[model samples]
Structure formats: C-alpha cells, structure tokens
Target: MLKKLLIACLLLSLIIAGGLVWSYQQVKSSLDLPVQTPENVLITVKSGTSFRGLLNHLAEEKIIRPSTWTRWIPRLEPELVRLKTGTYQITPVMTLRDVLALIASGREHQFAITLIEGDRFIDWQTQLTQAPYLKHASKTMSEAEIAKAIGASGIEKLEGYLLPETYHYTAGTSDIELMRRAYQAMMSLLDEAWQTRDQNIPLKSPYEALIMASIIEKETAVDDERGVVSSVFMNRLNKGMRLQTDPTVIYGLGESYDGNIRKRDLRTPTPYNTYTIFGLPPTPIAMPSKASVLAAVKPAESSYYYFVADGKGGHKFSKTLTEHNRAVRDYLRTLSK
Candidate 1:
C-alpha cells in the first residue's frame, strides 16, 4: 500500500510539470505568430483600457486570433500590460510581440496638414474638411465662432492669424486645437519679427506688418524678390501713392470676380481695394509665409514705386511711370510671343 501511494505521487508531479511546459510552449508560440492583418492598420488604445481588454478588442477586430495562451501575457509580463493610450499602426509583418512592444513603447502615429502661404482662410477650411484622421470640430462653426473657440477673441477676422506651415497631430486630434497652435505660432513669430523690425519702415504696428506681409506674399513667389517687392509697397505707402494692386481689387470683388480683372472692378470701391483705400486694408488679405513677414519689416532699400510681371515668373520693378509702362509693354510683348 505504501509503494503504490508513492508511485501515484510521482505520476501526479510528472503530470503537473508536463502541463506547465505545454502552457509555456503555447504562450511562446502565440506571442511569436504574426498579427493577422492584410495591410497596415491603425489601432487606438483609449485610456483605462486593460491589457486583457486590448487583447479582446484586437481579437474582435480579427487582428489577432483569440486563444487561451494570450490570457497569460498580462500575468507573465506586467510591464507589457501597461499600455499607453494613443493611435498605433500595426503592419502585417509585425508579430504579436512586436505589436505589444510598440504599444508599450508609446510611439504613436502622426498625420500632417499643410496651410499654404498666400492662401485664403477659406482655403484652409477646405483643407481641414478633407484632412483624414482629424476630428472636424470646426466644420460647422462660423469664422467668428472658430476664432472664439481657438481663444483668438477680439480678432474680427481669421485671415493671416494662423501660421502657414505643416502641422502634425495624432488621430482624433481636434481641428480647433490645430488652429489654436497655428494662431499661437503666428503670434509668436509676429512678435519676434516686430521686435527686430527696421524702425524706419512705415508699418506702425505688428498688425500693419502682417497686412504688408500678406500683400508681399501674394505679389511674388520668387525667393530673392520678396524684399524688393516689399520695398515698392513701402515706398508707395510713404509717398501717399495708391497700392493699385490687382489682388486687393480681386479680394474686394469676392465671388463677383470671374477669373479676369475688369476695369469696372478697379473702379469699384471697397474696404480691401488698395486702389480705393489710402492705407493698408482693414486686415491681411491672405496667409503670409515667414519670408514674406521678414521682408515686410526689413525691406531692401530702393526707389522702386511700381512693379509688373515680366512673364519670366518674376516682376519688373521701376521708379517712374514711364519705366513701368515700358516694362508693361515688354511683358505684353513676351505674352504676344
């Protein structure tokens, strides 16, 4: 009876050891298997999601096969279970271990939206509407309402307030947040430029500089010509000459502009029409880039009071009307050719 009892105890120990080894093998195999995804996919782990909960979510999404071995991951590796809440991308070639490590490392995916220089605020609205993965919080909000939402209170217009650059954000980030960042960035840059501006420039304040920058931004895209274009506008402003810029006239026309600038458009008076107004328009006409902003504050010293497109992707600047007419004729001659 004693020998039989000892043999039974030995068999029981062997069975228990074998079960432990089998469980270890199963868990190891599951962790090593590739995630079952055809292409790269984004997964958002929300706050307060447990390790087991995430595993269940993955299984439901068919990214991972549900198995009993996966249940031991949290217990065996407690550190891996401390998942960070963010959007993560998982690829087909990634193993279960790789996904866990990625999530644990808290490396979230980023998406970008670019606001272009010389583009209108309305253009940015269209871009925000089309940008993927971002929450369209400002879609239904009016410009005034959006300005208020982004903490840009007292700002009558939204144009030229937001900086033109590429902004990066994670999934589910709000458009309002992005706009706020842009506004703050522009404010900071504007302040820095204002502090270091040439004291002799005609701009009375940062706001006026912004308006000039917007005009410069629209006038030229040539890298070396920005300062010279700015100089022409500054000279005109100092001499009490009309800006007579077509962009301002077109801006005043709004939807009435039908691809061509007619004589009647210039004859009409509006707040944005530089030909009609004596000084800078009530606000910036469009978004200005950093270069344009810098050029507005620190223009190149020149006597040029006029400029016309030279048909070579640049402008021909002149100090007198006769020279300007000659340049215009030359531009027309180029067009004729």
Candidate 2:
C-alpha cells in the first residue's frame, strides 16, 4: 500500500512540472510573437501608471491580442508595474515588451516653433492660436484680455510680454500655459539683461529700455547693424525729435491699413503713431529681442540722429536730416533704375 501511494505522488508531481513548462513556453511565445500589421496607434501612458494598466489599455485598444496576456502570466510572469509615462506610437505587431521599452524611454512628441523678438501681441496670438498643440483658442479676445491671461499686469499690449525663442511644446498644451512659458522666458531674459545694463545709458527704467528696443527691432532685421540703428534712435530720443518710424505709423492704422503703406497713412494722427508722437509710443511696436533690449540700454556711442532704408535690407545712418534725405533720394533713384 505504501509503495503504491509513493508512485501515485511521483506521477502527479511529474504531470504538474510538464504543465508548468508548457505554460511558460506559451507565455513567452505570446510576448515574443509578431503583432497585427498595418495599424498605427498612439497611446498615452499617464504619469504614475502601472504596467498592468498599460497592458489592459493596449488590450482594450485591440492593438495587442488579449490572448497574449492570458497566455503570458502562467509561465513568463513579467513585472507589469515598471512602465513609465509618455506618448508612444505603437505599431500593430509590437510585443508587450517592445511597448514597455518604448514608454520607458519617454518618447513624448513635440511641436517646434520659432518666436522672433519684437513681434507684437497680436502676432503672438496669430502664431499660438494657429498651433495645433495649443488649446483654449478664441478670436474675440482683445489684446489686453490675452495679455492678462498670460499673467502680465497693466499691459497696454503684448509687445513686451512674449519671449522670442525656439519652443517645443508637448501635445495638448493650453494657451494660458503656453503663454505663461513664453512670458517666463521673456522675464528671465529681462532679469539677466537688467542686471548687466550699462549704468550711464539714457533710460528711465528697464521698461523704457524695452520700449526703445522694440522700436529698434521693428526698424530693421539686419542683426549686425541693430546696435548702430539703436544709437541713432537713442540720439533722436535725447534730442526730443520725432521718432518718424513707419512701423509705428503702420501700427497706428490698426486694421485699416492693408498689406500696403500709402503716403496718406503716414500723415494720419493716432496715439500710437511715432511720426506724430514726440516720444516713445505708449506701448512697444513689437516683441523686443534681448539683443535689441541690451542695445537700447547701452546704445552704441555715436552722433547719429537720422536713418533711412538703404534699400538693401539695411538702413543708412546719418547725423543730420539733410544726409538722411540725400540717402533716401539715392535709394529711390536706385529703385527707379
């Protein structure tokens, strides 16, 4: 009777071992098998998510077969709690392990954009509102409302609020957050420049310097000559002369001035018009870059008081209005030719 019982127990143990081996093989096969083809699915693994939850979510999406999991646990027990947060592009045939690896690598997608300094508040709205990743978009809010949402107070316009930089935004960012990031970037630049300002420069405050910088930025895109142009404007400001900037005149027109700037528009009277205003415009004409801001704070030492477009993507600097007129005439003659 004892011998018979021992044999029965031994046979039962052998059967269990064989079953466990088969189960292990099945699980491994399931995890290593080719995924279903031709389907590209984007899955988001939320922060603080577990590996099992990811697997279940994948199963629900039908990206991976449910049988893969059912067959997986008995033999090849995987640690289903180690997946990380991220946005992943999952192909149909990827193994569960491949998905985990991708997510663990944190391969979240990004949106690329370039924000140039000295761009106006309206320009920022145009760019951000059109971006797919930025949300909470509207067409009706005035510049002030938008500025307020971005956390700048008493803002006449968005001229100085938006920072210029190459930005990479994650998917589904709110407009307010995007604005906050840009605003923060601008502030950081401002703080750094303010600390290192040239002490003897003629400027009342950082804000005033920023305002001048905006004017300089709007005047020309030739980066190498920004300092020279800024010096000319600074001279005009110190001498109490009219800014005579076409951009401020154009800005004063608001929505009426189409893509063209007519002669009549220059003579029009508006509060923001620098051609008529004796000093700086009430607000900046565009977003000012750090370089332009620094240039305004410490304008290049010169006696230049006037400038006219040289018609070659730059301007000709002059110490007298007579010289400026001559330069303009020369440019017009060249254009006529």
Candidate 3:
C-alpha cells in the first residue's frame, strides 16, 4: 500500500509538470501570433480605461482572439502590462506582446500644425481653431485674454511673439499649451540671438530686433536678400530716414486697404506706418523667420540704403538716390511692356 501511494504521488507530480509546460507554450504561441488586421489600426485609449476593458476592445477590433488565454495572460503577467490614455497606432504585423509593449511605452501618435512665417497672429488663431485634433480652450477669447492666459500679459501685442514652425501634439492638447510652447521657443531663440548681436547696431533691445525682423520677413521672398535688406533698414535708421516700406503702411491701413497703397497711405499717421513713424513700428507687424531674426541682429556690411522691386521676384538694391530712381524707371518700363 505504501509503494502504491508513492507511485500515485510521483505520477501526479509528472502530470502537473507536463500541464505547466503546455500552458507556457500556449501563452507563448498566442503572444507570438500576428494580429488579424491587414492594415495598421489606430486605437484610442480614453482616460480611466481599465485593463480588462482594453482587452475587450482588442477582441472587438479582432486584433486579438477572445479566449481564456487573453483574459488570463494580463492577470498572470501584470508586470508586462501598462495601459495609457492617448491615440495609438497598431500595425497588422504586431503580435500581442508587441501591442502591449507599445502601449506600455506610451509613445502615441502625434498630429502636426504649422505656423508659417509672416502670418499674422489672427492667422495662428484661425489655424488653431480649425485643427480638429486640438482641444480648443480659447476659441472665443479675445487676443488680450488669450495673451494673458498664455503668460504673455506683458506683451503689448500678440503679432510677433509666437515662433513660426511645425508643432506636433497628441489628442487633448489645448490651444493655450501650443501657444505657450511657440511663445517660449521664440523667447529662447530671441534671447540667444540678442546675446550675440552686433555692436553699435541701432536696435535698443531684443524687441527692436524683432520689429526689424518682421519688416525683413515682409520685404523680400528671396532668402539671400534678408541680410542686405536688414543693412538697408539699419542704415536708414541711423540717418533718421523713413523706412518707406509698403507692408507697414498697408498694415496700418488695416481693413481700409483695398489691395492698393496710394500716396495718401504713405502719409498716414498710424503707429505702424513706417513711412511716417521714423523708426521701427510700435510692434512687429507679423511673425518672422529665424533667418530674418538673425539678419536683424547682424546686418550685412553694405552701403545700400534703397531697394526697389526688380519685377523678377527680387529687389534692385541701390546706394544712391539716382541709382534707385533709375532702377524704379526700368521697373516701370517693364510694367508698361
């Protein structure tokens, strides 16, 4: 009877070990199998989603099988499971383990919005309001209110404060957060450029450099002309000459401008009318690029003080009034042709 009892115990122990090995193989095979979807799937895990709920979602999407293993794996291996809230991209080739590891890593899909150089603050607001992915917090707020909310209350205007570049964010990101990031980026770049600014420049502060940069952004579309344009403006500033830039006058005209700048527009007395202001505008007219900002701080060494559109997507720079007038006449002759 004792031998029979020992034989039964040994047989039972072997059976238990064989069952454990079979269970391990089953779990490993399930984790290694690819999902059913032919294309990549985008899954959104909402806030406060439970682990069981996530498993159910995967089963519903047919990414994983609805079986005992699916239910038991997460419970048994809790250390390998981490659930997060955001949009995730699940590929067809992903295994159960790959999907779990991706969620655990919390690297979600990012949506992008670009703020173009020379765009006005209103344009930025429009893009933010139109982006379907962003969580709009200031859709109806005034510019002043928005500025205050973004910790920019000290800024007199919001036109040139934000940097122009592509910004990527996940779902539920607020407009205020995006704007704050842009503002901070511009501030950091401006501080760095100001620290290394050329000596004896007429700019009183970084704000002045920003004002000049905005003008440079509007003056020319040619990348190489930025430095020369900055030099022309700086030379004019040193001589107390009016900037005579059409964009500033148009900006001052605002809604009144009917796609034309008459002689009267140049004589306008608005704060933004550089043709009459005798210095940089009260604030930047638009967002400027990094190149324009650098040019503002370090203008090219030149004697040029005048420029006219050459009617070829570029400018004809001049060092004397006679040369400028001749270039203007040539441009006019081309227009007549």
Candidate 4:
C-alpha cells in the first residue's frame, strides 16, 4: 500500500511538470495560436489598475482565453500587480506569459509633434489641444504657461520659444512635456546662433535677436531672401528708421486686421507695430525657424535698407527709399492689374 501511494505521488508530480512545460511552450511559440496568425494590436496600461483588471481587459480583447488566464494566474503569480502606465503594441498569439514579460519590460512608443514654419500661435495651440493622448490643456494656457514649460518665466508671448521642428513624444507624454521639449530645443538653437552673432548688431540681448528672427521668418517664405531681409532690417535699425514691416503692423493691430494692411493700419500705434516703433517689437511677433534665427544673428553683407513684395511671394530689396518705392510701384502695380 505504501509503494502504491508513493508511485501515485510521483505520477502526479510528473503530470504537473509536463503541464508547466506545455504552458510555457504554448505562450512562447506562435504555433499554439488557435486563430489565423500573429497580429498587431495597441494596448494601453492604465495607472493604478490591478493586474487582474489588466488580465480581464486582455481576455475581453480576445488576445487570451478568459478561462486559461483565470485558471493559470493564481498558480503562476498570485503576487503580480498591474504594470506602469504606458502605450504598448501587442501581437496576436501572444499568450499570458509573453504579455506578462512585455508588461515587465515597459516598452512604450514615440510619436511626433510637427511645428510648421509659418504656423500661427492659434494654429500651434490647436494642434496641441487636439492631440488626444496629451492631457487637456487648461482653458487658459497663457503665455506664462508656455514660457514656464520651456524653462522661462514672465515672458509675455510664446514666440521664439516654440521651435519650428518635428518633435518626438510618447503616448504617456503630457501637453506640458511636449511644450517643454520644444522650448528647450529652441533655447539650445538660440544659444548656438547667438554665440556666432555679429558684434555690431543693434540688438541688446539674445531675446532681441530672437525677436528679429521672427520678423525675418514672417517677411519672406523664400530661404535665399532671409539674409537679405535681415540686412535690410539691420540697416533700418542702424539709421533709426522705422521697420515699416507690414507683418509687424498686422501683429500690432492684433485681431482687427481684415486680410489687408491699409494706410491707417500703418499709422496706428501699437506695441507690436515696427512701423510705429523705432526698434524691434516689445516681444517676438511669431515663432521663428532655426534658419531665421541663424540669419538674424549673422546678416548678409549688404547695404539694403528697404524691401517690398515682388508679386511672387518674395521681396525686391533696395539700399534707398527711392529704389524701394520704385520696386513697390513696379511689383504692386503689376500684381494689382
């Protein structure tokens, strides 16, 4: 009777070991998949959720069998807890064993935030707010909020800090995090550009250089004209002449612009109006690109003091008002007809 009982115990132990091996292979191999084949699926692991809850979610998603997990979890890992919060991509035929391994590894994803060169403030705000993964921005995301995100304080506008580039972010990234990355990148770029700035520049600080860069950005879409425009502005600055840039007037007029810069708009007084102000605006009027920043710090060698639209979205430059007005007459008159 004792021998028979010992043999029964040995047989039971062998069966359990065999089951473990089978279960391990079932999880590790794609051949055990009951469905078509391996498939891809996006999974989000929520914070503070229980391991059982996650298992239940996976079961509901049909990635694993409910009965199989319910039977195996207690036996395999009773002390298991939910994973850290993140976005994960899972595969079909992935069993509980493989899923647990993934959770432990915490492999997340990265996505992009595209900042176009010509995007307006509201346009950037819309892109940030519309991103579903990022936390909802507060109803009032003030310039201060934007400033602080990029390691600045008390800045009146978000321009210059909001770099024009494609940024990579994870699904777990917050709106502030996205803003922070952009600002840091812009700050770094500014430092690099400012280090090589011309000594005779009229700008007092790096901030002022950034201000000039934004003007350069708004003045021309053509890359080659950026340096020329910078030279024109610098010349005007040297002579105590008004910038008379139409974009500055548009920015100064705020939301009142009707798609046109009328004569009265130029004559109007506003803090942002370079036409009315003797120097750079109180703050940057728009976010500038790296190229624009570089161009501002290192203007082209020229005596150009005036520029006008050349009817092809570029500028006709001049060293004197007479020449500028003539170019304007030629270009504007040609376009109007």
Q: Which candidate is the best by lDDT?
A: 1
Q: Is candidate 1 or 2 superior in lDDT?
A: 1
What value does the lDDT take at residue 176 in candidate 2?
73
lDDT of each: 0.92, 0.75, 0.88, 0.77
TM-score of each: 0.90, 0.78, 0.86, 0.79
What C-alpha lDDT, on a 0 to 100 scale, does residue 83 get in candidate 3?
81
RMSD of each: 2.4, 4.1, 2.9, 4.1
lDDT of 4 by residue, 192-297 (tens): 8888889988888989998899899988988999988999889889989988888878877777888998888877788887777788888787889998999999
The candidate with the higher TM-score, 2 or 3, is 3
- Deviating ranges (above 4 Å) for candidate 2: 1-41, 45-86, 89-96, 102-107, 137-146
What lDDT score goes with residue 293 in model 1?
Answer: 93
Better of 2 and 4 by lDDT: 4
Ordering by TM-score: 1, 3, 4, 2
Q: Given candidate 2, what's the lDDT at residue 9?
A: 94
Cα RMSD for predicted model 1: 2.4
Superposition error at 195 for model 1 (Å): 0.6
User: Highest TM-score among the candidates is held by which one?
Assistant: 1
TM match of model 3 to true structure: 0.86
lDDT of 4 at 68: 48
Off by over 4 Å in 1: 1-15, 46-53
